[model samples]
Target chain A: MGQVVVVTSGKGGVGKTTTTANVGLALGMFGQRVCLIDTDIGLRNLDLALGLDERVVYDLIDVCSGVCRLQQALLRDKHIETVYLLPAAQTKAKTDITPEQMRTLLEQLKPSFDFILLDSPAGIEQGFQNAIAGADWAIVVTNPEPAAVRDADRVIGLLHGAGLTDVRLILNRLRTQRLDARSTGNGTAGLGEIEEVVDQLAVDLLGVVPEDERVVDSNLQKEPLVLHQQDRAGQAYREIARRMLGESIPLMELTPPKPFWRRLGLRFGHHARVERK
Target chain B: MGHRDPSLTRKWGQGGKRRAMAYLPSHIRVKGSRDGLTFYFDGNVAMEVWLAELQQLLQREHHLFQGPAVPVRICFGRVPLGTEEAAIRACFASHPNLIVHRVEASSTSITSRTGEKERTAPTLLWGPVRSGAEIQSDGALIVAGDVHSGARLVAKGTILVFGILRGMACAGSDGDIEAIIAAWELACPVVEIASRRKSFEKLSAGPTLVRLEGEELVTAPARHLKRGQGGREQPWAKWWS
Candidate 1:
């Protein structure tokens, strides 16, 4: 049976759909048969993110409501042959699929795929409940900000309450320059350290995706970042995928480079201090 | 209805009373009393729905209740069990000045036959109060975890947070000038003690105490409060004296 993983974040616009698409694509690149399911219902974006919006003939609601078979609704990716997309219905309400129906649908698809990824909607509402209904593991995406961290904590609490104990943290949109400036006292409020976030959420760190402009370009081009290969965010996603596959890959160091003057000043200052000592 | 408002009669008309009643949300009933505005929850609707409506009502009328002295009462139709009271209190988390004067179950069994004033114990919150969550106590209030931004705590007496305080906090909510607000790390954007309010530019990293001094709210290191001194003999006694 395939392992079902749900990507969820309580707060909106924290990149739940992007992480699901890229990670699923990376897993498929590893020769695993992966199926990505969009559970956002009315506000569907996974299809657009995967560049398969035009190819979708049916959606999850259609399969759940018996209008079509699950195989008929699954859209094969053009680039990754092992990856498939199960789009969400744009016209239907989020409450269209109950948790029991979602569980049954995931169970039915488990035998055919190696990994099933559910892209959960924002908020702790019916959509969130439906997304996590049949998941064996949960990946909670959050930013370095306080609000997103708090929401992730709440999601962790809820996931634990639902008996899904294997939850990991993904810190997204980390701005290295901003964090460096804050650490050096140039910035006012620091984006908290990763250790603080891990301590607050009490979850294992899966990966950290630095804030990269290429992510927006990928979204605009309707392509998965992992396919870009050279993009830093894409490499981060690939590393995360490898980590998810139980590989012990070291985390990427994302420190921002300082200006020439600052580096020169630090070097000379260090020489002067050594001579004085 | 002996105390029915004549204006409501004129607005609803005699035959349209049922329609007017249906227009209001059945789960919530708001009324004005000598103590303050009282909100009665009938337990008919789900807690989330009731909280949403309550938040909407408060946000719509926030201008009218902008100060720290506005006493508010939350009365449940039945006594809440477990975290139900905490959930109910979370609805008022954004309104820092809205003082919760009393929270009680309106059931007759809990009320005393002698008609004396009802006393409520201080609410003890167990977990980290997240953003957009609020806790209000008619008496003293204590929280065991951090209070995030957009969350608030209002207490008629002392407000003590065992963890970091990063949100808005209002103590002496009922106009008690001697009330104190203490936290492990004081980093709140706004802190109010009775009518005195001060915004902190830089938050202290260590434990801190905020209390009123001659009508001005002052912050001092909590360790200097003089150990073994109790009651009015403490260093903060100058405010009450």
Candidate 2:
């Protein structure tokens, strides 16, 4: 039986759909059969993110409502042979499929796939509940901002309440330069630090994706970042995939390089020289 | 007008006044005593009608009772006043001399005098209250775990959380402004008491207490409340001591 994982974030625009796409793609690249299911229903964007919008003929609602067979609704990715896309229904509401139906659909797909990734809709409503109904693990995506952290905490709590205790946190869109500046007291804005976020959320760290403009470029180009091979965010997603596969990959250093003078002072073992009067 | 008219006095006898009183609404009852005058009203009556009757009575006897502003005790027999309390105070706006010594519900008074505290057992929740989960309590509420964002806890009395609070908490839901909300760590966007709400951008780490102080909602470190400030014993701490 394949493991089902739901990528969810209580707050919107926190990279949930992107994470689902990249992680599933990375798993497929590793010779595992992966199926990416978009449970956003009325607000379907996974197909667009995957550059497979033109190929979608049937969706999750079609499969669940018996309008089409499961294989008929599954859209195979052209770029990645093992990866598949189960697009959500744009015209149907989230209530179109009940939780029981969602569970049955996942069970039917479990035997054929190695990993099932569900891109959950934002919010703890029926859509969210339905997405995680058959999930064996949950990945809560969040930014370092207070609002996103709070929402992530809420999602984590909900995941636990749903009896899916194996939860992990993915800190996305981290601005390394800004975080370094703030820690050095050179920045005025008080964004929550990674440590603070991890403490507040009380979830294991899956990985941190730095603020990379390439993510937007890839989205605009209708390509999954993980397929770019050279993108930093794509590398981070690959590392997360490795970690999920039980490999102990060390987290990449997120702090930006120090100024020349500070680097020289540290090289010469004169730490006090870098301090301002 | 002061000259004695025996025939008119005979026609308007004490029994005649008592007989006429039957036609009046039961809510509007006034009693005179050596101490002062007391006004009692059944809380079920519409506020507009109650206030109108009081205004008319005051205006009709303004001359007779003009010597000094007598203290008046207005009692609402079972009315909670709640958010509508402001309207009651507005009724006495014109009569500045009619000192409102106390405004209380008769039911509360009876319970207090008899030493029988009204018990509203809190609803105890053992797990985290997730987003979109709304829990309402008729009395107090006790949550053994975190209250997540988008989640809501509404209680008629107090709300006590053993874990972090990152959601909305509404205490004193029934208009008891003294009700408080305390949590292990408060990072909520909003905390409300009897319709009064305070939005917080960031909260200090650790346990916190939120209550209505004067007209505003004040948040403070829970430890400070336990130590008692300015040599005044904290009522909340008294339970532990």
Candidate 3:
């Protein structure tokens, strides 16, 4: 009976998929027999994130439809041998699989591995419902924006409605410099604003990921930054994984430079910090 | 966007190759069998070392490494893995290019050892929790009566109280921070989501929705209520003789 954890968000573009890809990869590196199931249906992207898009011969829809066995549908990532991926169908819609069916799929997967992570689709509709059906727990991923937090709040409400309360929050794209009450001109809020949101929402904070362009570049390059080992965002994701594993790893201390840095910023300063062992 | 064969190009050049190559401390155990490579790390080891080892191995065999994303299964034996490990795995999966996944100690241990065992199935809990009843678990906790000040209601999954919750209530203990404590009137029902506390006061007013915002708890208008308006004033305040 392995735990089934769903990584979800109510709004799109807040890094739900990115969080799923990074966290799953980091967990696999930590020696957990891990399987990632993308439940975004037609808008599937987990495979691409892991550089396995070209190799997905069978998909989640295929497994649900009995077109292929769950194991057959799972595409093995070339990098980490133990981790497996079951991608959502590119052609299917949200209603293709019922919650019961998803639950059955997860039940079958539980005994074979230690963890099954579902990459839930955005919004509180059928897709989200199906994604959460079989999950024993959930990881709610949100950005620091007010809109994102509100949406996360809504998602938490829905989870409550569903009688599924084991949901955690991952604050993605946090801009640390904004937290310095001393700073005044940034678009994103600082730690104080984030704390207000967290206090208002009443959920446990799993981790905070900073806004890193390297994540974008790695996505473009078909490599997760977490695999880079030396990337800051990658390290943050790694630290998050360690913290999740009960290792009491301290939060990373890399605060983004204030606007002054923007005026006189060096190109490799951020990169140099990440490279330190 | 063209799909290149990714087969032996300057994936990172020779320097990138060097960085990716090499043994990641050799302390972490990677068992390669006919099925695939299984990584085994002690329950006490830091997750960072295992991740570094995986990356180093992946970089070393950037070309030949083919199976599934590495299934790094931790053999914790009887030791229970907490929510942090699960959170880390979810974060790892969020990465754009990584294929790592997660699992924990056997299912029996997690369910019996930590989550379900915290609070026993209370057949009958009498009276309002005055100070410390510390009720918590994955199952339902039915309080026969109302809860008073300083009392705590913590549950791994759900917490349903038949009476008024005048005291503290924390639903979804463990990592399930999504739990909610609904009552006839949320009058200053000090509520905490996971470890974060929402409003300690009963709004002293009306219905409230307490949930996880980021790292703390928040209480606001339910869906039916309009936004930006200060929540209904504590009706009890005016009535206080």
Candidate 4:
């Protein structure tokens, strides 16, 4: 049997689909058979991200409703032989498939695949409920903003309540620019540090993806970011994939800026130091 | 002895249609545990028949108890008790060997006095409480982790957090001002006790306690209470205790 993981964020536009693509592809690079299931029924984007939009003749709904076999709905990546893509139907709403159907589908695929990642929709409605119905684990993606962290917290609570207690956090789109602690001036606490987000959610930190323009460009280029070498976000996803497979990998350190750059309040040549495992 | 779903009885007894009431076991039952003795009354049976059955059972089994009068509770499974609980209590008053502790309509109904006094066990939560998430208890609540901002914790008695509290904590929600809300560090933006509210923008220097004093919420350092000492003046030895 294989492990099924769901990538979800309560708020929209928080890189859930992007994380699913990168992490799923990264696991494929490690010689594991990975399947990416897009559960965002009405607003499908995983197919576009994986360059399989044109090949999605049969979707998740077709497979669940017995219109097509599971293998017929799955499209193999032309380049990466280890990974597969299960696209969502753009015309159908999330309620078209019940949670029992989703769970049954995952059960049939668990024996053939090594890992299944469900790309959950933006809200905690029927779409989110169906996505997590069969998931064995959950990856909560969030940004450094308060709203994102708050949404992540609510998702974490919902996950625990639903019995998906094996959850981890992935802090995404973090700016490398470090802010001075004294600048928060107000009496309220500022969620500037990644540790604060981890502490607030009380979840284990899986990996942190830094803010990089290339990540957005990869979607347009129809390429997974992990295939792009030397990109900070790509390296973070690769590291997350390694940690998922029971590897003891420490977090990449956020290097401090030069004294001259710090004094000038400029970010120049700041990179996270990572020792390859 | 088995726990019966309260809804199975209420819909049939209250609505008076009783299409499904025939399936309910038509007998008076009794269960005894560390909590107390509970006399179970069926919703389908007539109240007079239930009383007679219970009296007959007690009369036959009174020899089993050689001690003083035993405190027992009366429970109505499916009946929607509007104002007849007193009549049931008055009928039970003639049983000299039994002391009536309470009469409960349902075990899970918050409106019942039984839920307020006995059913409310301090709920212990594992991880941090998130924003927009809520945890409510009829009596007391204790969080083993931090409570993030925008999260709400409500309890009828005391509210204690083993970790930091940066959210809202309301204790003694029914205007019992003595109920206190404590935390390892309190930086809550909103805190309420007995309908009174206060806001804390910054965390105190040490572990803190919040309680209502003379219509105003007051904060004080709680170093004396100490952690691992059961978190209160006297250690709560058991979960039920």
Candidate 5:
């Protein structure tokens, strides 16, 4: 059976859906049959984020309610042939989907896909429970802020209580430049701040995505960043995908802040000018 | 070939079962009843050696007394159970003691002993504790994670939680009155420490600590307690309730 991975974060807006989109795309690029299920129900965004909003004819609710077949609801990604999107019903509330229903749907989808990625809704409500019902593993998305970490810890505790211990942490939106600058200001608090989280949660550090404009740019373009070959953030997503597939991709070397002119060249998409500069 | 002795005839025909071989030191005394077994060891016997002798004696007559129906009680003058709880429990779960049903302690310091002296370093388990996860630790119980709602944690000593405690936590289960259960969040009201439970309606939020006071498990505020002052001075240090 395929592995069911639920992307969850107790605190909202910590990149749960974004991680689902990118990781799903990255896995698909790695030649895995990936099906991304948006379990947010009423507040669906995975289809939009993956640029498959218009292509969604049937949704998870349709399949769960027996109105449509599983094959009819899966929206195959135009770019990645192996990737499919199962959108949530924007008209139904979180309670519209029960945990048992989700579990049944996941079991049905298990044979057809290599990975089932559930984009869990924010909060620990029915939607979150539904998303995690049949998940073999979970990826808890948390930012660098203490509030985010605390909520992530709560989610970790809940998942652990649920007997889901294969949880990994994906530290998102960590502005290393800011952390470095803060470290330079004070003598010791620089790395200590980041290391404390890893120590407390006691989980594998899956991957870190630098707080870069490319992430937002790719999102605005309605394309997963991992699809962009040149974006550094996209490269981070690709590395996480590779690691998930049991590949040992070396951590990408950070691109040091370029000179003002070089940054301008990079911003303008002129690689030759930046090289010469 | 003369199987004429009443005791020998009784053993040969009655499944070869023998009576529980009792051990009584000359200087001290012991008493047995349907409820429990009590040993009054003189304060003179060193705890370790006396316990070792007691276990060796039990091992010698293994087949006769296999499983006892009543709890075994080891009474002492000022001298406590010779071994630390871990060692004592191992000895008790040995051959003879297994036949005995439950183990009971009625010493004057049974409460204090159960908390500090008897309790060994708890076997800390860190993982998703699912339902039917049976963890019986003689020492203090430290679940470095949350206990699922249906999971049960039965510890002879204290139950310390570095995470949420939604499961049932039975602390002081081995008759330790001083064993306190401290959890980051105590929502489980069905907690029983030494046979005392507070309903879920009575459970409070935030950091909580529950202990047995006067044969009752009372929920109290848990503080970032320092070591060695005992539970008295740190009483009500910080109230999460």
Candidate 6:
């Protein structure tokens, strides 16, 4: 049976859907049959991220309402044969799917895939509860902000309360948020801030996604970040996916690489100092 | 209810009754009940003068007031005792006798203001006491894990945490001035004890204890609290039983 993972964060705009799309694609690259379920309901965006919005014929609601079978509702991405996108209904509200219904649907789809990633909606509402109903593990995606970390703690607490023991954290937008001196507390966080949050939440760190404009560009271009090879954020997502599969991998170094001239100069200086020694 | 400085209450055995009954204030009426003395204050008198006369009464008739350990319960007749209640507690503090037990208003209950009628046994918990979670106890409360921010813990008696405390902890919620809150790590912004509260701007670096000392909240290192044979939880063992 496949392991179902829910990507969730309690607060809004912490990149739950984006992380879901990218991680799902990365899992697909590893030869796993990946299924993506967008449980955001009215705020559906997973199909657009996969560039398969036009190919969505039926959705989660239609399948739940018995209008179509689960396979008919599932949309396979054009470029990748291993991944499928189960779009959420744009017209329905978050209250549409009950937790029992979501759990039953996931149970039916478990035998067909190696990994199923449920893209949970933001907030600690019914949508989030329904999305995590059948999830064996949870991935909490958060920005390196106090508010986001606080929300992630709340979500972890809820998951623990529900007896879901395996929960991991993803620190996204690390060192990438623009610092604003005018604002009260909305600014770029440092390594110390990330350490404080990780300490406070007390969860296993999955991976860190640095602030990269390419990630935003990927969303705008209607393609998932994992589709773009050799990208920093894509590599982070890949690492997270591998970790989820129980592969041991060290985290990427967060510091940006130096420019070519600066690297060359430092190398030459180090070599001359070694020759003198 | 408490001994002011542990200085007296030994004088209760002497002949303390014959020399009293000189004068009793008009607004204040003292009655003997099955439990100890109950003082009823008329609401018409101003709060200051009422407290002053009560103080003078206890001062002049100090010999008559020294008796059993049952706390003296006061009833405020038909008036809202707001901040005036704290002033009343302050008055009781200097008596070297008499502790403020319960505040009885013509409006509120005589039993439970913040807790049940009687304080129960201490509650022991294994916890993160997660965000948005609330834990309340009639008696003392002990947690083996962290108390996260946005969480709340209120107890009628003392509260003890073996891990970090980053939430709101209110000890002495039922107005017991002797209650305390101690944690392995303290980051609580505000702490309330016996209806009095104090806020902190920074986190405490080590194990700390927050308690009430002479009508004010004071914090000190919890390591100073003696521990016995019970191991790491020894200090709180007495509170549990």
Give DockQ per model, in order: 0.14, 0.23, 0.01, 0.46, 0.04, 0.39
Ten-residue stretch with the least lDDT total in model 5 chain B: B232-241
Model 1 alpha-carbon drift over 4 Å, by segment: A145-166, A179-202, A256-277, B1-127, B133-144, B152-159, B168-179, B191-202, B212-218, B226-231, B234-241
TM-score of each: 0.62, 0.65, 0.51, 0.67, 0.58, 0.70
Models sorted by lDDT, best on top: 2, 1, 6, 4, 5, 3
Q: For every model in order, what is the number of clashing pairs?
A: 1, 0, 75, 1, 8, 0
Model 1 chain A poorest ten-residue lDDT run: A182-191
Off by over 4 Å in 4: A179-192, A256-277, B1-125, B201-205, B223-241
Show where candidate 3 strays beyond 4 Å: A180-190, A256-277, B1-241
Q: Candidate 5 at B145: error in angstroms?
A: 7.8
TM-score winner between candidates 1 and 2 = 2
Q: How good is chain A of candidate 4, measured by TM-score?
A: 0.88
Cα shift from native, residue B108, model 2 (Å): 16
| Stretches > 4 Å off in candidate 5 | A182-191, A254-277, B1-241
Model 2 chain A worst lDDT window (10 residues): A183-192
lDDT of each: 0.80, 0.80, 0.66, 0.78, 0.73, 0.79
Q: Rank the candidates by TM-score, best first.
A: 6, 4, 2, 1, 5, 3
Better of 5 and 6 by TM-score: 6
**For model 2, how big is the iRMS in angstroms?**
2.6
Best by DockQ: 4
lDDT of residue A108 for candidate 5: 93
Candidate 3 CAPRI level: incorrect
Task: Give the alpha carbon lDDT tens digit for every residue of B1-241 in model 4.
Answer: 1233344445533665462333332355565644446666665556676666555555445554335677887766665475557666666566665678877665321222223245457888877888788888887799998898789999987898989898889898887666788899887888999999987767686688887667998787776443313233222212222
Error of 2 at A38 (Å): 2.4
* Model 6 TM-score, all chains together: 0.70
Candidate 5 lDDT over A44-71, as tens digits, reads 9999889999888888899999999999
Error of 2 at A130 (Å): 3.4
Candidate 5 positional error at A253, Å = 3.6
Highest TM-score model number? 6
